[model samples]
Target chain A: MHNRNAWAIAPLMALSLAACSGEADKSADGAPPAPTNQTLAEVIADKGEMDTLEGVIRNAGLSDVLAGKGPYTVFAPADAALGAAGSDLSDEAMKAQGAALLRAHIVPGALTRADILAALERGGTGGVQMRTMADGLLTFSRDGDAVTVTAADGATARLTGDETVAANGVVQPVDGLLVKAE
Target chain B: MKRLIPLTSVLVLALCASSPALAQNGNGNGHGKGHGAGNPVQQDRDDDGDDDRREGRRNGNGRENRAERDVPRNHRSAEVRVREIVGDPPREGERAVRELRRGLERGESVVGREVIGPRRDEVRALLQGCPPGLAKKDNGCLPPGQARKIDRSQSYDRYNYLWRSFGGDGGYQYRDGYLYRTAPDGGLLGYLPVLGGILSTGNVWPTQYTYQQPPQYYSRYYGLNDRYQYRYSDGVLYGVDPKTQAIAQVAALLTGQQIDVGQRMPAGYDVYNIPYDYRDQYVDSADRHYRYSDGYVYQVDPTTRLVQAVIQLLT
Candidate 1:
């Protein structure tokens, strides 16, 4: 009687284990995964070259939006670019640049590097006139291997290195300080 | 023992009654002889003491009343001094001068008391000497035909003299050939030339007269409506209107997303970022996926991705 009872209990335990494994597999296959598009915050965290720009971003109090889930085209300047332009990278200078200079760097939509370059080539004015987040127009000039950007106030800046893709936006490194005309 | 107690009680009552009477009499004469007999010298002394106390009280009341009356006068004098220091009286004086000017402009005689009595003859002579046949209207003085010609010739010879004495610019010619000067109101100051003829009423030649025109409107650069250009220097943004070249310093205290120089920013485009490479172009590419020519950073629009910040930089 004892031997018969053990045999019956062993089969029931095996069936229960099998049912648990099947439920686990179904659950794994049930829902879709998270999206692959990185947010602006994710992009900044991933790209390591935006330390100086990051400081400015914080001082200008733009961390929250840049870190949010949107496709933004950020014309990011490197430490060297700011140095070349003779901008004292001081907290005071960053504060002085304020929102106006920052607005000049951003566009409304996410523009890929290829799309921007292609736009510059097609615009035919030797550059493409892109309205900035500041309502000011930024003109893009292509020279051989490098690109030059002129602000509405006639301030010119050069892109030194390459484009960086963040989860939320794209950051293009620049080599000079672009100031608004007074 | 009971009888002794009653005797003591009676003695105590007598003593209490006697004490008050002695105190009342002590302030009066020291006499209790017979009915009202007292020391005459002591009575005179008491009377004199009472009189002195009454006199002191009267004097004190008079002093207090005098002080109370003087307080308002002192306050009034202080107020007058403050008004004088603040030049309120001078402003009033200017108002009086304006009234006089208005009266003169209307060709009306001004009547006011002088330091001495009014000199009616002097005033009449001054009025009679005014050039004959000239328009006596406000800011209107024109010389007659012959006198105008003579003055013109003389003005050419003595331009500086006419400019100093008659306040005339000989070079300036009005449409009516009236030699007008620059008035304080920025309008034409007209003057009439004096002829060698005495007025019919008096033998006085009108000379050294000044004409004042009404105030005119002048439009300055501040009145224009144009976009203001801005430049950043020493951490401050300065607004410069390209059309007028008017410069205004932007206030440092600002918050929002837009870059406005003199005007307040609108609602939606309030988030801002500092511009990178403002004047020149920059090339940037990384990770082999993206590339661009101009590396101008901007504050991107959150909803529509539109860039709506102030174009502070102008060519």
Candidate 2:
């Protein structure tokens, strides 16, 4: 859907691998089943609540770019939202705005949370913008079923978890790091 | 500083052009950026005469479209290119290129309407692994033994790439005035913020259809954001947010359809960077550069080659 152009596999990870398979691998266009060949940079380096956003995406070298094949959608950030936004991550965020602050929390493609709630229900708007590979932008929106995002200075963030699903991309995890340190 | 072109009849309604898809090609022109005092473009209906028609070819029977090879005629107005490229205040680039031409003419009137129930079967299940217009209109991908043939000897306007007179892999520097994009081993990479300088590829920038190269997951370079306005076609590049005229795409280059995130992309052809091992298994990293087409590959931007990212890889 141009989350920049997905398809390393992300139909919301076949509805999150069919709600983690309780739905018996839901497919037949119910979408949702296959995930876990691992590599959204190895499920965010096997998340421990994403150890400081996985050491700032491997010190922002981008860990061979999320383990290759651009599946992307990331958003990450939850080390208690970078230690509750004290977010300096030391050394002036390790300069180069710390890899543009981890490329704003990566977005390129592979989005999920049901593709940001079907892109905020087919874009009525308030959120769904995206952008990121460091050019920044962010927006998202949808809330009840969970999703939040924001930025471009409104600085929001919400999204919680239950959406890692890999093979190529989809991460979600947030709480706040939409940005604001320097 | 004045009439920067508005001798109006709504710009003589910019010569009554129309192209539901070529009715004798229809002239059109007038988006205007002007160089030698604009408004003369009317090329289709060709007498041929070996003029080479800027190199996207199809010279003879009058087929010069890229909206009249990007209206090079002295037309002027974005309050005269923001009072000549950024002195600014031309009623804010004429109310942001007239609301990005009414939101890209209302998203190009729903791009070939004919939806048919259930969202046309979910846009035909997202055009599955090809067919139903395979490679769409030659922006790339055809060689499944030439899938019913239509190659254009490496296509053009909708871009197929490889031409610095065929040695074409990369070149163009100009710097500071901004034109940049070098990379094919030569390096340089991002620059083209645009204001002009390569005045002699001789005629159409990179010899017409603007040289082609856009896919690096496109974003940034809206002239490094000063509220955004930059526009161009075929050779990609677009940003326009001037009070929500909303288009942001910034470069597209190719599409057989089915791109979603913010949507847009699909103006037909013009996208590049098709070499680095040609599709090198759809990319692993070097930041960006992938091109393919129709069955989808795209990615681009190895430092602003342009596109930002897009993937479908035929399934």
Tell me the DockQ of each model, to 2 decimals. 0.01, 0.02
What's the residue-level lDDT of A47 in candidate 1?
56
Write model 2 residue lDDT over A34-140, tens digit each, in one string: 56777887887787777766665554344655675555567787677777332433222232233445555665445556545654665565555755543346777
Looking at candidate 1 chain A, the ten consecutive residues that score lowest on lDDT are A25-34
For B1-315, candidate 1 gives per-residue lDDT tens digits of 111011122211221122100000011122212211121111111223321221101112222332223333222111000000110121222243343234333423111110111111211112222234554333334444323444443423222121121222332222121233435554444433211112101222122321111000000111212354332221122334545533332311111122211122233222222222121221222211111111112222233332211111111
Q: RMSD to native for every prediction?
A: 38.8, 24.1
Candidate 2 Cα outliers beyond 4 Å, as residue runs: A1-72, A79-81, A86-99, A102-104, A111-132, A135-169, A172-182, B1-315
A-chain TM-score, model 2: 0.31
For residues A67-155, write the lDDT of model 1, one tens digit per residue. Answer: 64333567776666545222322343233233334555766444544545665654565676654544455677777777788765567
lDDT of 2 at B232: 37
Q: Which one is best on lDDT?
A: 2
lDDT of 2 by residue, B1-315 (tens): 222222122211121111111100111122223221121221121123211111112124344434434443321110100001111122332343443334333432111211001111121111122222223222222334455333322221111111111122465332212233355675543332221122211112321212111211122211123454433321223344556544443322112133321133332211221212222344325554344332234444344343422332211
lDDT of each: 0.34, 0.38
Candidate 1 residue B32 C-alpha distance from true site, Å:
99
